[model samples]
Target: MSDAQTQKVLDHIDADFDNSLQRLFALLRIKSISADPAFAGDCKAAADHLAGDIASLGFDARVRPTAGHPAVVAKSNGKGNGGGARPHVLFYGHYDVQPVDPLNLWHRPPFEPVVTDHADGRKIIVARGAEDDKGQLMTFIEACRAWKSATGSLPLDITFLIEGEEEVGSKNFAPFLAANKDELKADYALVCDTGMWDPNTPAITTSLRGLVYDEVRIKAARRDLHSGLFGGAARNPIRVLTYILGGLFDENGHITIPGFYDGVKDLPPDILAQWKKLNLTPETFLKPVGLSIPAGEKGRLLIEQVSSRPTCSINGIVGGYTGEGSKTVIPAEASAKISFRLVEGQDPAKIRKAFRDYVTARIPGDCKVEFGDHSMAPAIALPWDMKALSAAKKALTEEWGREAVLFGSGGSIPVVADFKKTLGLESLLVGFGLDDDNIHSPNEKYDLKSFHKGIRSWARILAELAALPR
Candidate 1:
């Protein structure tokens, strides 16, 4: 665990990186698109292949069945190096890539992995799941490989929990975790599905927003009524539905639900000051997405609005309509799908109840409202001073030659919360993905540097983590 020892492992990583790329390419070639039933065999193949590969590195690895795609669970105890005293860590990632729809947009076949030069002259590995997960996950696996080859064992006990259903909402993954809870115990988890701050700056995601999704239907009449006859007398469900949803946010963009923001709190002053230095602006973060304004709470910084604030969004709405042209009719029912992104300290159940209450309060007595619960998950917030977090920051800084940044992600990784719920484990979210990786899009690529140096970074991180006092 000394610096010289870490450097030796890093040197081994550098020397064997070409073989690492070849290994990643082999995994990418399996076409493990978990969402498409046509690729079910490929998903199994990817699981078998990855499990076999991990098992070769002195792990007790297997492809375990789930309700959906099978998951790979691999375990190692450093071959007696720990003697049960080393801190146990779990590493999580996914093997399944998004489907290659609109395949013509890709310059090359989506399944054909290749090393190519970007327009900016940087080398990239282009393939499905390149930067999204497969490539990023391999960085850690290769690091372990390097350490095993160099020192004949890893620095700490490790477990790998790679799944095939992440891109498909991980519906079966939580159940799998519950069933295998006793076998997957760990002090903490390391997830490799997020992005760095920028191409050159590493980052640790310390918080993730939770989610509540609901579908509501407003039924005003027993049957569709002709608007020509019911225009003034009968109630129009679409009109009623739109009116309620339109008022969900005030002019200043704060959600108008009662008690919605009751538990929300501002970031600490020190963290706020650091974020101010980040200077995230509309031109920098929004312009590329064809936007010029921050649309959350008016007074908060753009960074806070997007990454730290809770938000409500109307994902879709539908009512009576015409196939080819407008029909003069008052729809019997209108439905809307809504979701809320929740931050730490906010209870998803409470927020969902508040939203339902708000909607029900405005429902006319003549109209019947039916609610359909879709999904709900609580937010995740890691301690700012966790020992593993500090070790990861140091490891990344040493490998990247820049201070590692920490930030809150507006999005939710439900598995992170599931780990906490099922195994009493917190997760450290880290990765080498960049902003332009185009994951879930055509021509997805991982920076060659992200692959090579990412391996070295993990090698250093494992060493640093092992040296921490128990």
Candidate 2:
């Protein structure tokens, strides 16, 4: 691709930005809340609307049915330069928004998107799905539209996969992917569901922590007992549960489970050096949360503690309680929900087994223990030297006039793992969201600049990817 052609696409994006915002507003107006059964029609409407919009760009777009809300699949004509294959990418996004609960808190209707001035003087587009995904996804679509209008063709083969069940756990989406794996094949996947380092800085999420959510129930007695009558003789399940949980971590904040770190590896020297320069301190990362200490494994960077290192957290615990400040009873059963944030090289199943074994070994002889599984997913880490990653990073850096930060996120996006496992494709995660976007909350907004510049960024990325050797 010629630089002149790329410049034309970027120029078109700048000129047509108003129309881009309008299109995003049209999408944001659809109350496609996947979690509520009452909004099922809205979800289908979103799918159909997106399919038609994408089809306007000459793609073979169609709304396909899933077990739940439908999915939009659109593919380019696949005519490569000189009849040779080019890099093909499957762009992924969601059309669903979280339920707008507590409607009284919103300044305007959650479905009514508008461009407004932020308190910080930045132009923001406020709506329920503004930043979470509607705005973010439209950035890529608008970029494609610009390229198509400017050059009459896309720079490479493309497939669009927009789903409507992300907010809900995507339970059926995975099966949809499995059933259509052949038709959805691509060289790589592009996901816009993440955030940048900061409003001024660009970022590519190179790693995502996996999850192991489990619940443990301990029962020491069949019936509740009075504290006064059995306080000394009865084996309290709550006491047993807390005692075992207390030993799972050491003073240094490292998990004490055996073989928990079997496959864990340290970051590369170059990446570590870059992270050191970023200088993520507790004051900047934790102070806002009313915390002042780095509470992960000792001797690790605060960034590493949250992103790269594996961790175990007790999400919730419930046990015997006194009601009305009068009744004191040792409940027959006590339960706790625990979760583990895993990193690359750590297996979720093994971690889950190790944790269960650790708790089982420490249980009192008379107490009975039962474990319930909630969710488990392995961690994902992209190769540091991936060519597409380098290309996209260069494009973002140019767009933002600052070096893009390749960072690891502490949370998980299961679809990225599914792309690798099911389609044999790695994902390149890039987005223009800020830390305070208030996604999944009231009054969610997307920066107007992020919307416009994000289109320009993707246009440049497409050009850079096309220039690579086929």
Candidate 3:
């Protein structure tokens, strides 16, 4: 475990970098778009392709059938996955990608994968699933292949669970895991769907805030009425709807729902102080979004505003009619899509209940309300003392030659929580994705360096994990 030994592994990764790109290009060409049914055959093709590729590395690899698209379940056992002196690691990624719609925006055919350079002097690989999953997933697979080629086997036990429905919320993955619990068993999980702290610095995601998405509709009169005729008598549902959501926050900007904070707590003061030194300012956090104000709880630091505080936002609203000119009519109904970003231990059901109560209390006797379903997910916050994290952190820092930031993300990855609750496992979220990678958008790309060094990163991580004291 000396620095010299780790550097040797990294050198192996750099030398075999072209093979890594070739493996990535092969996956990117498979067209595994899961949300669209027309690509079902392509999805299966992608899964089978991955299974075949991983099998060459001496894994018991296969494309397992799911109710939706197929999943690649590949594993190499007993290098200590069952908690022998060696550690077992579950590496998660998606082989599927979002639909490449508005394909005209792309400079070239999305499925015609290629390694290209960005306008800035940085290297990039462009394709439909380039950086989203295929490229990202291949990072680990290529790393394993390199390790196997160099040292004859991955330094540690590793299981890969790349699915075809992650862009669609991984509907079949949880059940698949439960059915194959023993085969998929691992001490912890590693997810590569997240991004780095910056283009240059590496990051280990320690927390992902959960989500509680809801759609609320407000109804007043039974039918549309003339605003001029019923201006005083009929209730304006749009007005009522706006008033209800507008009151979701107080003057200090905290969510006003009762019990929303029931289980919410502060990050340890030491961690808070460390985050403060990281300088997560409005300039750094909001400048990209064209805003500078911290819009959460008034007294908290900007980092707390995003990572720790639960928030309620109205995503969309539709009510009155006005295609061109004013219709002068009062719409019978108004609906708004409101979502709550929940923090660790914040119950989605409780937050929904509190929000409904607040809305019902605000409604006039003449007005009625209905709620619609969107989606909800609980937050995940890992213990700082997890030994696996330390082992991986050492690898990342060594690979990048810079201190890797252990940080919290404001977004939610519900499956991470599902993995812990349903299977009793903690997941380590790491990846080489950068913010500008344009994930979930047309022309998505992963940095060529990210794809190249990412393989190397995992190679080092595997070696470090194998060296951990279990």
Top candidate (lDDT) = 2
Which pairs, if any, clash in model 1?
none
Model 3, runs deviating above 4 Å: 1-5, 78-85
Give the alpha carbon lDDT tens digit for every residue of 103-175 in model 3. 8888899888887789998989888888787777888888888777766666777888888898898888888
Using TM-score as the measure, which candidate wins? 2
As a whole number from 0 to 100, the lDDT of residue 229 in candidate 1 is: 85
Instruction: Determine which window of 10 residues in candidate 2 has minimal summed lDDT.
Output: 77-86
Q: Can you write out model 1's per-residue Cα lDDT over 385-463, one digit (the tens) per residue? A: 8999999999999889999889999999999999999989889998999989999999999999999989998998899
Ranking by TM-score: 2, 1, 3
Ranking according to lDDT, highest score first: 2, 1, 3
Model 2 has an lDDT value of 0.92
Residue 101 shift from truth in candidate 3, angstroms: 1.6
Relative to the true structure, how large is the alpha-carbon lDDT of every model?
A: 0.91, 0.92, 0.83
Q: Determine the C-alpha RMSD for candidate 1 after optimal superposition of all C-alphas.
A: 1.7
> Clashing residue pairs in candidate 2, if any?
none
Compared to the true structure, candidate 1 yields what TM-score? Answer: 0.97
Evaluated against the true structure, the overall lDDT of model 1 is 0.91
Question: What TM-score does each of the candidates earn?
Answer: 0.97, 0.98, 0.96
